[model samples]
Target: MGQFYCLHCDRYFANSTVRDEHFKTKRHKKRMKQMSGPAPHTQLDAELAAGMVGKARAPDCRGTLGAVEGLPFIFLLM
Candidate 1:
């Protein structure tokens, strides 16, 4: 769970010897190859991509969702 954990393979070994052996396995190699590509998106990533949330929201500018579509200006409130 601590030192001998394989993040890409998501597996654990009893000791370093077994873990080292696991690193030489075809399945582990394949998993490492797959992980070498683009990383998978998380829930926060999905939300940001879909405009559900972001780093910071302006005082008046809201999302073009549910109500606004082609609106030119945003409504400001006091």
Candidate 2:
């Protein structure tokens, strides 16, 4: 359950150490090269990527876990 996913490559790691290792690997870096850049997506973009309906919603300020996919990698709400 503890893992970090590579957004660019859609890969996952069990821990930060492994994640860091993956980041350093040639294959991982190569995959990263395929990305447009490190620009963060806007809330609207993130919502669309998460497959939500019109009017992107922000996660509850109460810090509750809501609908999500590939959790730990992408949080759709919160």
Candidate 3:
């Protein structure tokens, strides 16, 4: 006898037969539908979009600030 785990429902079944039956349940179907959709944005994402968060600096190449062969030497140092 082995246990079967359902990730969506967070429940365990005695066997694959029971687990397969659980997958056909309305609760499991609803959970699947909810998980299939795109995730909602969080407050941090909203702040970043609104420019409230500090903006990231753009890569500076232009053969300046120790750029070797068009690639930043700082990256190689890392």
Candidate 4:
């Protein structure tokens, strides 16, 4: 396993020296900036998810789910 890890970048670094260099990279900076924004869940999204409470409103599976770029995994209750 790597000694240093960057959560936003989802990468591991062998050492602090390499990790510091990675942190200063434009790619890492761009990724960090992108990850620091607000979530996409709007009122409509909340309303849709809330439907899980009632089986009548629930879809055959989960109601239409959304996929955003860059997210490795996400689970929304619905």
| Count of residue pairs whose backbone atoms collide, per candidate | 0, 0, 0, 0
Give per-residue CA lDDT, model 1, range 1-78, as digits (tens): 546888888887778999998889999999889989765655544564577774484334354322333465545898
Per-residue lDDT tens digits for candidate 4, residues 1-78, read 997999989999999999999999999999999989877665545665565334465433243443332333456699
Question: Which scores better on TM-score, 3 or 4?
Answer: 4
TM-score per candidate, chains pooled: 0.52, 0.41, 0.52, 0.57
Better of 3 and 4 by lDDT: 4
Error of 1 at 32 (Å): 0.5
Give lDDT tens digits, candidate 2, residues 1-78. Answer: 656888867877788888887788888888777675654545545555566734335443123223342344435786
lDDT of each: 0.68, 0.61, 0.65, 0.71
Displacement of residue 43 (Cα, Å) in model 3 is 8.3
lDDT (Cα, tens digit) per residue for candidate 3, span 8-72: 78888998898999999999999988888866755554554465654353234232232123553
Identify the leading candidate in terms of lDDT: 4
Clashing pairs in 1: none
- Steric clash count of candidate 2: 0
Clashing pairs in 2: none
Candidate 1 CA-lDDT value = 0.68
2 versus 4: better lDDT goes to: 4
Best prediction by TM-score:
4
